[model samples]
Target chain A: MGAEREPERGAERVVVGDKRKLRLATASLAGCFGCHMSLLDIDERLFELVERVDFDRSPLTDIKHCGACDIGLIEGGICNAENVHVLREFRSHCKVLIAVGACAVNGGLPAQRNHLDLGQCLQEIYLTAPDIVGGKIPNDPELPLPLDKVHPIHEIVRIDYFIPGCPPSGDAIWKFLTDLLDGRTPRLGHPLLHFD
Target chain B: MTQPSILLDGLPVPFVDGQTIMDAAMAADIFIPHLCHHPEFKPQGSCKLCTVKANGRYVSACTLPARDGMEVENNSPDLNDKRRTLLQMLFVEGNHFCPSCEKSGNCMLQALAYELEMLSPHFDQFYPNRAVDASHPEVLLDFNRCILCELCVRASRDVDRKSVFSLSGRGIDKHLIVNAESGRLADTDFSWADKAAHVCPVGVILKKRSGFAVPIGKRRYDVEPIGMQVERLAARSADEES
Candidate 1:
């Protein structure tokens, strides 16, 4: 090895002379769309971001399938079979993968059900909870099978970075993205590192 | 008699006759990073967050009495790494749910994690089935967030003289329980004015209807790191004694 540094796995080198824009994708699994809302909170700065980045397989683009991309931000936990499939596919498509928000990082609010029996939880909601008449648990092959427990994305696939907030502030996301673009190790310190 | 001292992270820290390593460290405005070793209460050394190497042996700094020439490694990388693991273990052991928690920014456990730069929970969450005791009209005891530090137990017994709280069961099954036969907070004499009512380092014991009185970003730990805040408090106490 000479003076040159090898790029880390999932970290694509952005050469100064390269003219191609970076491809970015995002996916939501078992979470509220709050993380994406925070991403949109980037607001007008997103217009400036598109000048250097391209969106693929994201709610922003309304694309159902993820294509090969430079970075992928996955929100929410793995709570169902579909989430697992989507996460694995997303991981394969992106060079860099980030677990965004508390859900992606540590299974957030959805994980409150982790201690409960999934079957019992379903039963309580549909059959027993309150005023209910002839409630039945839906069992359709078209519906995604729910997992026994909600798990953070890293428990299922490798995650390059973690933004640890319920929904990380848009400014924090912007700082992390700009740091990555500038070839610096992304660090969320002080106010930005909040979990809530 | 000459005051004994310990070399804490290569820095000389003086201690009086009966003060522990934590006492000396706090007196010197040095942070040892602890959860259960509150200055107001007697040190329990239960959490083990303040584990430090004293003369080549690991000991809880909060409980161990300082000796002259004792070389302690407090902030070593290995120790901090261990501390990070401890923080992660604590996070996964409980249903922290910081976003939904009223104690988010004011919580000591969350603040300590941020101070230690804990990025993820790092292990599969245990997420043990727990309950919230909202029977008390003035207080709420969410058993989900307890780290089993027993600060509340000590505070209730020693300070408030209520003995309203105790840890029951054993091993993985160990849990906090109320003193009343009915097993509810409302059945006990725990008032909002009690020391035990306010000693929780996490979000377990909370005031009813007082959630989110302070905005998210404006709370105690959000403004600055825990180390700075603890040190400032220590310095303020030292100034008061003089």
Candidate 2:
């Protein structure tokens, strides 16, 4: 918490003594969680990453919401009102927002339903499916209402960076993060930019 | 007479007098990203991914013929940004669920998008509802994935000589239609072994009952990027000709 202050003029001199770790927040909106799993695929490097960055509010720390942070890594598409809210919150709170994986970047598999009528989709899933014993399209006031169509996060918010893949490879993620931390624009080329 | 040469990104590429910029580049083992220009068929500059700047003017490499001293610019940031936008339009225009599609790895459209490093669709999803034609006994025509490159149309007319496929409609409504009164592949003389069936660059024309036989990671573009394959093939052809 002590390290979360906004830098004042000439704060660079004071920061040499403070030694604040950069804060990172992450969230999954409407994806399969494959991207988050791929992040963990960084494996042993997680130890090194933890030393350089702190989890401000993320699934890694099971934090409910984000605080003022240096970076935000968002996975998944915007499928409902709740996603829109969380995305806007991240934009306001974080200085840099990175849309990670195919879903976050291009609506991925979930956007396949974009061609189908939302009402018919809900009816098929919730009421007409063979496995359902007694099901209804749950319209609880607490639940988020579905958007007419799924959308990539960038269509709704300003995303500073994108890592594209069904689940972007661990190496790509590592390179992007380390490059960002080292003050370089991440360029995905050759083997790094795979779609399947 | 000696062959005329064009400068592609400052590299000299020799071309036959009548060859398009794309054909000359391919013969030189250079890759200009494209979807509609298959070697087996006539060039159709439908997919403009192979757009390159020639002497400060942008033109589709697939259709534009090469001329002596022509200076072509490819693989640049400005051109790639435009290519990325074109790829994005294709993505959102159709429901391209790469993770679930049978042609996930082998699809040229997906591979080109990857090569361009198109991070996001960068546009709203159109999600145009399209139908799948599983009526054919040995082939599946999933219209959802068609990029309208006209490869199948050209292959059927020129190679198979069956005239089994044709494009119908205009603009957003344009689609691949079977060449039959009933408008179904089953009603036509189309077969799985036809050149038209094999010429589809995307998942639109998939062989029935042959899904995922090669496994995910070992698929065509998965093993090597599409550009590398084109370059390798070009090199092999050049070697054979010499």
Which pairs, if any, clash in model 1? none
Q: What lDDT would each prediction earn against the true structure?
A: 0.88, 0.85
lDDT tens per residue, model 2, A112-142: 7787799998999999999997999999999
- For candidate 2, the docking band is medium
Instruction: Show how many residue pairs clash in every candidate, following the order shown.
Output: 0, 0
| DockQ scores of the candidates | 0.64, 0.60
Clashing pairs in 2: none
Model 1, DockQ value?
0.64
lDDT of 1 by residue, A1-196 (tens): 4335465422444552266889999999998989999999999999878877899999999999999999999999999999999999999999999999999999988887787899998999899988978999989999999999999999999999998887899999998998997789999889889898
Best by TM-score: 2
TM-scores of all candidate predictions against the true structure: 0.88, 0.90
Chain B TM-scores of the candidates: 0.94, 0.93
lDDT of 2 by residue, B151-238 (tens): 8898899988999988999888898899999888999888877777776777898878878777766776677887787754321111
lDDT, candidate 1, B129-213, per-residue tens: 7878999988988998999999889989998899999999998888999999999999988998887877788889888887887
Q: What is the interface RMSD of each candidate, in Å?
A: 1.0, 1.7
Instruction: Kindly provide the TM-score obtained by chain B of candidate 2 when compared with the true chain B.
Output: 0.93
